[model samples]
Target: GESVGLHLPTLSVQEGDNSIINCAYSNSASDYFIWYKQESGKGPQFIIDIRSNMDKRQGQRVTVLLNKTVKHLSLQIAATQPGDSAVYFCAEITSNTGKLIFGQGTTLQVKP
Candidate 1:
């Protein structure tokens, strides 16, 4: 599947501001979730991940949160910069299938 959908949600932020990206997953059985950042014409890069057993996890400058009740996930980026501008995606991997199903991406546009 294409990483970026035809109509992606856009998130605009200022430099040095915190950015929060949200996603809604479909499968309740998915046990693992990963966040990816894709720059223009570049492949997706691993950002952070969270497992079903955990509700929240933090990375170098990012945080991932999972809510099973609503099948919701969110990524928080601290002190967003122009370099952080890109399309962000959330993927879910079910233990049984071992397949990564990518959700719709959100384009992050950063202002200087």
Candidate 2:
């Protein structure tokens, strides 16, 4: 059976430190990958994204790495702050359809 979801339920980090969030996906046919950050009461906000053709992409303070061979994905946040505390989710979209399949979310807690 095929599966699409997150690998962890939560992550804890100290303020001013870096944070690494991991996710595992199942569909090798998926073409697009995205990382989103959701706050306490807000919708998921886009962080970074990568296509299947690429293995890595970098944003302002975030980096998204994609490994198609093992079907793994990771998000790295630089200088994580208290404000960065939120639930993070990884989503994938295939070119065949516009629908996006979201993985189980991982809660990120930043300790000051």
Candidate 3:
């Protein structure tokens, strides 16, 4: 089964810092991965993505690293700011349907 439970509603951080958020999935057969950021009341925005065959991928200020050996995934934000405060989600694309299975998410708070 997938992770189904409550999580910390938010996280607070000072401006101009680094942030790291984490998530785990249940299916080992998942083939694609994506990271998204959702602001206060808006829908999710695509940040970065990594394929199952890749180990790491990078973008402007974000980086997504996947370790299939342990089925672990991580996102690193180079510099966190108030503008960066939002709920971050990691999703794995399942085979067959190709639907994205989203993680619980981590809310990052950037205090200015």
Candidate 4:
């Protein structure tokens, strides 16, 4: 199936730094994109989203870049913080299903 999965178990970084989380998708027909942030024991919160027609989208503290050419995507966080320390997921949506196909998750570790 063309769902998301995680490549590594964890990623460790220091506070006040920038973090880049990567996601590898499975389906090439996906059109819309979204990024989510999940705490230790909670559901994912919407972070940012982009469409296949666009290459990039930005939020207050986060940015999402999509590379349809390779079926890959990435998320960039401006400053690493304890609050920013969580699991991240990338989702793809198309005209069909109206459901999102997620990518392999990446865990952001903030070392204070």
Q: Measured by TM-score, how close is model 3 to the native structure?
A: 0.88
Model 4, span 1-112: residue lDDT tens: 6686556657889999998888777777888889999998999999999998988988998989888888778888998888999889888887677887776578899999
Stretches of candidate 1 off by over 4 Å are 1-8
User: Which clashing pairs does model 1 show?
Assistant: none
Ranking by TM-score: 2, 1, 4, 3
Candidate 1: tens digits of C-alpha lDDT, residues 23-111 = 88767788998999999999999999999999999999999988899888899999999999999988989898788888779999999
lDDT of 3 at 19: 79
Where in model 3 is the C-alpha error above 4 Å?
2-9
TM-score, one value per model: 0.91, 0.95, 0.88, 0.91
lDDT per model, in order?
Answer: 0.87, 0.91, 0.80, 0.84
- RMSD (CA, Å), each prediction: 3.1, 1.1, 2.2, 1.4
Expressed as tens digits, the lDDT of each residue in 1-112 for candidate 3 is 6441113446677788877776666678877888899998999999999998898999998999887877788888987878898898888887765787887788898888
Arranged by lDDT, best first = 2, 1, 4, 3
**Higher TM-score: candidate 1 or 3?**
1
Q: Which ten residues in a row have the lowest lDDT in candidate 3?
A: 1-10
Each candidate's clash count: 0, 0, 0, 5
